[model samples]
Target chain A: MPEYTFLVVEDSPTMRQLISFALKRIPGSTIVEAGDGIDALKKLSNQKFDVILTDINMPLMDGLKLVSMVRNDPTYKDIPVIVITTEGADDARERGISLGANAYVSKPIQTQDLLNTVNEIIKSKA
Target chain B: MAKDSDSLSKKVENFLKVFKKGEEFTQELLQENEKLRYRLAQQEEVSKSSGRGEALNEQALEERLKTLEDENKSLLDRYHQVEEENKDFANRYIEVETENNNLANLYVASYQLHSTLDFNESLKIVLEIVMNLIGAEEFSIMMLDEKTNELSIVAQEGMGQDARKSIKMGSGIIGQVAKTGDAFYRDGDPTNLKGIDYTHPLVTIPLKIKEHVIGIIVIYKLLIQKTEFSNVDYELFSMLAGHAATALFSSKLYSQSERKLTTIQSFLDLLKEK
Candidate 1:
């Protein structure tokens, strides 16, 4: 029973809550919220996180920039990143993965799909 | 001397006969011993072969047992794998069921919205649909005033009092959509809640009866966790545009008819008194 700390970054409170709700279903999972990419970076600096789930579109900084920054940083670079993309944003999904995101989930998200993606990334990393 | 020689010969002859008989008897005994030995050897060979056959059978049984044990282990492993697969499928089925339930709830909510003929109740239902189903945090339902040619807020949520100003027809985004009967959706990310002007809402659905626009549903911002509008949201919007307008219109007409009926009844009563 390993404890997992997750950093969820999204501009919309509703989406963040939904994703967090799904993530909380995993046993021993601790969730931390961020409104955008900048806020995510701040949280990353404060403490270690096992996985990062971020929405691609945001007010100040989008998820792609955050992913690239995380990938570049020596400390957080190894942490798995899962990008949340809108349903039709195929280009953005590809770009996010190319930018070093481990995996992704489309918007209008199915809770099961999101969970499976996160669980897979976490298991692979473990 | 002749008599003694004859007697020696007779004695030799008898001794020879007796010696021959003894030799013949000894030869017979030796032959019997050899036959017995051959028989013993054959019996010993048969007994040794029986023992060897038993050993081979034991070895074969041990090998068969080992093979069966291995097969049993493999079958057990396969059984566990199948069990795991079944559990996975069950989990997936439950998720699908939950999704179906949510969609059903939305359907029921929409049905209830149209069932009501009361204007206020219609507004309440619309608010619930927007807030709960659409995940709108800041929104307002503005009805078009035919006389004034303006759109006024009939019901609102999460907006300041000062923000609820009426818009002239074809004036701003909400008004233009109301005038044209075309829905207004902001380009790019709906969740990007930075510098949101109340005039330009995230979505402005013109509630229409055919080509005629009756009212507008303006959503300035969505709830924090709502990343983007889903397919169901689009469907909901399409539904509200037509059904909500008809409900509100019918209810208003019903209210007006009730008022006229009341006036006519009072006049009849007055005439009877006179």
Candidate 2:
């Protein structure tokens, strides 16, 4: 798998670190942090990351808008966007998937399961 | 007949000359040798069996049986040791159960006191109860500050200023509950005095009345990693939070009612004077 930079866009600092903790458990990872969707875009403008791990609710710009923008961009269009959220209903999940998110993870995440899915998604892209 | 016997004995002697001297045991085992010839040679069958060769075999068999008996005895001793260990373990389990039951009774009594409306007094009582029940190395409650939009330590037990101040809303694991109104954990580093480590398997509960979040009730290091909060702990805390919420809300209404009662009494006196 190509070397990846996991950008965790979460407003809650605790959740940000939690997701970061789970991601860092993966071997040889480089993580980029963002407080919200706008912060994430600023980081994206500076450089490209392998996969984007975003939360649905954020200040400034929400995750749905971010996904739309990322998909529209010719340069970063192919990048897979995975939306991590607390909402588990079909409609909520369909909203994220329709917005071009490659995957969705429910809140109070299962650490090992997330890692396994992440590995598979990244490997498939290769 | 004597001549014939002498001739046969010379032939036998000549054959026996081929046998080695120390091969007596082999000669004794030979089918061709008869007791009658042995009697003529002044040896008896009874004496051969009862003498050196049989005695040596019997001695070796007894030694083998003696070692087997020793082995069996050692196994029997080990079995008794294991039985004693099992009994000790059972006794320990019973002791633990007794202690756990005692703590549970105490927990129920303490939680009953939480059914009072005065938030400050109620919280103080709750803190005292928690301190008395599960003693941690340190404990503190952080609530999200609406104005500051940060977390501040409101109540504390067994913690230093540095450890308490080391925490902030939206900064550490404790801050998650304050910010998101969701109960969560934060991993602590030994070097820094943070709220308990997230990995430490502590429990956090956000106090809510209806949909509004008031604060969180946290039990920290009630037990070490080896022991997680029991079902009793979870049930105990849940009941405590519920009672606390109802009391707090009722207290809020009671205070509000006092204000309105005074306002109405003053207005009635003004009307009487007019």
Candidate 3:
């Protein structure tokens, strides 16, 4: 299998770390971290990513807007986008998905579920 | 005739065997067709039911997601409100702390003002209080001599030699305050120092002994960090006005009494020797 690169966008450092830790389960996977949607966009423009995992609520630019921008952009539209959100964020999740988020994982995210979802999306794309 | 009967029976037997075989084959094919048709119907039903179930599930998920999003929004709003409240509390805490600190400073200033009986030491304490607590960098304490009607500098800080050493009573703002026995706060005006070589006077507190004005404390300039005097500084000035004069006056009387007592005691001893 080819090496996979993932972009993790979350405002909370701890949440970002947890997601990064779980992404490490995939062999030969590289992870990039961003503090918020704006930072994620900067990183997105600068590099290539196989998948983008983001939180719904973030400062300076939310995950929904990021998803819209990614989907609208020709270069990054096909990239698999995942949303991570709290349990009560149904509306935000819906917006995220409608804007072209491929999947959403609710908190507290089970490591296996996260891995399964990510792997399935990557496999389907592959 | 017997041979002819045998051949007809054989032909009839052959026809019966072929008819029976054809009927059995037709029955088997119909049963197989019916089983295949039933299986196909079941598969179609399963697929239709599953498609309906998936739609229902997606609808349920959408509803659930909506509810969760509302709850999340509510929680975030509450979190922001709590953060605002915390910030307000922190600001209030700082204000209260500063007020307490100012009160503490005033108490310390009053204590230092009356801690000594020596006139010079008392004057030094007053200067120290003004410089340290009142945040004045340039100032002086001047005593009024009733005999000459003149005010002379007793204690001074942060002034050039060209600064005024004496001011006759009834002359300038300083004289007006001394004559009227009223304290003056100039608010650190540069206009007041336009023609004067002396440093600017921000405030002048009159020191009173009973109803009489005994001296004046002139605050020439405030420290660089302090922009202006507050109400608390005025409160301190009022406290110094009464207590400072009493301390100085009583200490002068005490020394005079001690000297007179010593002379009388020595004279009595000489009489006892006689």
Candidate 4:
């Protein structure tokens, strides 16, 4: 089955739930939530996801470090890591690239852009 | 007459060697008679007139001759000293110029080695060249493995298999370069790089693309040289890292494109069958 599986790495439960709800509105989709990189890694070891949406700031591990860890790992390196945060700065973008993040989306994201971008990357990545 | 004869006799005694070997003795002997006659008249006048001006002229001539002789001696001494100094200077300049040429050659060679395509080949060539050029007895190029995603010694020089196998990224100078994406140097550090004696000055350059923290290039020069890692090393290693990235990216892309083309062809075949 050509189903869309998304792994959302966010520290906030409310934001996670909110994003999950919005993502569910899209057809042919399933959602998995991880609180941090460590959690994300645990889930990643078990199953593969179509996209890895991560947050910049987290307790156990931040999004940038997670992306680097993912990119460094041969198994998970190819997965696209989109950094979701309230920050948008040159340094942040440069840092994200260095850490091997695929792309970036600002926080308080509009549900429409998120859905559209997710679809596009999954489509292109596929 | 006797007084004049005695003075002339002393003059001849002083210059006996000068006249002894010379020719034309008959003409000089006739000249001496005229000089004696002049001296007889001059001495008579010296007793009569003040004769001070004539004495003064003679004294002036003697003083001038003394000064000229002293100046000639001084010039001879100076000539010898300058000759010695020029020789010393030439030797020193040759030594410095030779060293500079050697360093320039090494820099060019290192740059060429850094330009190579294969990672292991580049590392092996770089470490060996650095060891030879910089006289680093112990050397390694620890890289972050693309597959394992961990810093590992993919290629190393001047080491046994076990020694090479033990080096990992984030562990020593090489590892720190991979971890921090910056160069560091520690001379006989408080905490040494394990296994390798802390007997050399370690030069580490972070193999980074922007801030990727890819790996480290270490040049372990002798311990006593007081040579520290510089922007120069970072600049060189970073250039090598840039080349490494192109090689890596090209290989990755080539494989991916090859696979994509294969997949698309297979799909097309299925469509044709249908």
lDDT of 4 by residue, B5-121 (tens): 345445545444333423234345445545655665665578458655577655655565566556555655655565565556556554543443333433454454545455445
Ranking by TM-score: 3, 1, 4, 2
Question: In model 4 chain A, which range of ten residues has the least summed lDDT?
Answer: A105-114
DockQ metric for all predictions:
0.02, 0.01, 0.01, 0.01
Instruction: Please give the range of 10 consecutive residues that has the lowest summed lDDT in model 3 chain B.
Output: B188-197
TM-score of chain B, candidates 1 onward in order: 0.63, 0.46, 0.68, 0.49
Residue A77, model 4: lDDT of 88
Model 1: per-residue Cα lDDT over A106-126, one tens digit each = 765666788889989889989
Candidate 4 has a DockQ of 0.01
What DockQ results for candidate 1?
0.02
> What TM-score would you report for chain A in candidate 4?
0.91
| Best candidate (score: DockQ) | 1
Candidate 2 accuracy as TM-score: 0.37
Q: Model 3, A1-126: lDDT tens per residue? A: 689999999875545665776787677899999999999999999999999999888899988899999999999999999998655558988888889899998765545668889999999999
Better of 1 and 3 by TM-score: 3
Q: Lowest summed lDDT over 10 consecutive residues: which window, candidate 2 chain A? A: A85-94
Considering every candidate listed, which one attains the maximal TM-score? 3
| Model 1 C-alpha lDDT per residue in residues B1-274, reported as the tens digit of each score | 2244345546555655655565565556556555655655665567577766555645555565566556555655655565565556556555554565345445545676777678888787778678755777789999998999999999999886557579999998888999889998897767655746787789999999999999999998776668788766887799889888888888888888988999999999999999
Candidate 2 lDDT by residue in tens digits, A1-126 = 457788888775545655676677566678898998889989998887878998887889988889999999898888888888653345656788998999987654445556777787788887
Give the Å error, residue B107, model 3: 2.2
Point out the worst 10-residue segment of candidate 4 chain B by lDDT: B221-230
